[model samples]
Target: MKLRISHETTYGYDQPIRNLVQSLRLTPSIFEGQKTHDWRIEIPGGIRGPGFRDGAGDWVEGWTLRGPAEEVSVRISGHVETRDTAGVLRGHREMIHPLAYLRSTHATAPDKALREAAMSLETTGDHLELAHGLSALIAAAIAFRPGVTETHTTAAEAFALGQGVCQDHAHALITVARLRELPARYVSGYLHSTADGQAHEAAHAWAEIHVGNLGWVGFDAANRCCPDERYVRLGSGLDASDAAPIRGVAMGTGAERLAIRVQVEEMEQ
Candidate 1:
């Protein structure tokens, strides 16, 4: 399948910002499951810095805006061809060891409740089955509600609430997987839509676990399935903040507001 993605982010400030620097991980992963056709990142009036593929095999690009500026806009447009690999990440080069992901970050730190939930699960020593079970458990435990949680919500908090969006599910799954001693990390990406080809918002998140022989396999608890051709992986990290598509700081003491719009659609081949 072929997909076209358009993502735009705008920030407005109460007072002019003196300087702004941003790091973007917006490029898609180069792997057997997907191939990039045309991709571009645009920031009007901003200076583009050198971009490189990081240790994790994701492209990292920098941009700077020096100004008494009140607004900043970042836009990304791209096309990719994807194939379904049953969520198995293959042919992607990275230097980090799988064990590095076993260490939990703040967002995925397991609490007493989370630990108990992981310990109580039934497993027959089959890693694959256990991984699937964990995904299913999370999906059943948390009800998908968009406005119930924020970006800063922790896995433990979301688990206790029993409701959240895809980010919550991904974080919770990462927490539980680590509790079981399985290496897991957060995945940031875009999902096309439902199986019936219905239109929906595209930005999405999921968890990837390392099994003994299978490297990293994706599991999206919120969607109750592994990633398929509909998924376009951008990057992976310890948590949402680490894996954020865009991270930056504005040098100013002014209040700021942000607005984002994203669209993903299938293109005729």
Candidate 2:
């Protein structure tokens, strides 16, 4: 399948910002499951900085905006050909060892409930099965409800509430996967489907666990399935903040509001 994506983020500030520095990980991944074409980024009146690939094989670019800027817009458009490899990440070059992901982040910290949930799963020594079970458990435990959690909401918090969006489900699953010693990381990407009645945000998130033989395989607890052709992976990190598509700081005390639009549509192959 071929997918076209359009994403625009606009920030409106009550007071003019002195400067804005943004680091973007909006580019698609290079792997057997997907190939990107005609990708572009536009930031009017902004200076583009150096771009490079990070340790986890995701592309990163820097942008800077000058003073007295009341509003800023960052736009991205791209096309990607995607294929399903049964959720296995293949042909992607990366330097980080899988063990690095075993380290837990604040957002993914497992609590007593999460630990107990992981401990209750039937263990057959199959990491893949265990991973699937972990995802299933999260989906069953947490109902997908937006606006109930914040960006910094932790896995333990969401599990306690039993209600959250996709990020919470992914975070919960990641926490439990780590409890079982399965290396897990957060994945930020796009999903082209909304028919499942799950959280289908234009920007989607999931978890990937490293099995002994299959390597990193995606599991989206919110959707209750592995990522497939409809998925366009962007990047991965210890948690959502680390894997954020846009990370920026405005050098002023001005309060800011944001407007974002995203569309992921299927195209004729």
Query: Can you write out model 1's per-residue Cα lDDT over 35-123, one digit (the tens) per residue?
Result: 99779899988999999998889999999999899999999999999999999999999999999999989899889989998888898
Candidate 2 clashing pairs, residues 3+ apart or interchain: none
lDDT of 2 by residue, 120-152 (tens): 999789999999989999999999899999988
Q: Score every model by TM-score.
A: 0.98, 0.97
Candidate 1 regions exceeding 4 Å error are none
User: How many residue pairs clash (N, CA or C atoms closer than 3 angstroms) in each of the candidate models, in the order given?
Assistant: 0, 0
What's the CA error at residue 135 for candidate 1, in Å? 0.4
- Poorest lDDT segment (10 consecutive residues) of candidate 1: 194-203
Local distance difference test, candidate 2: 0.93
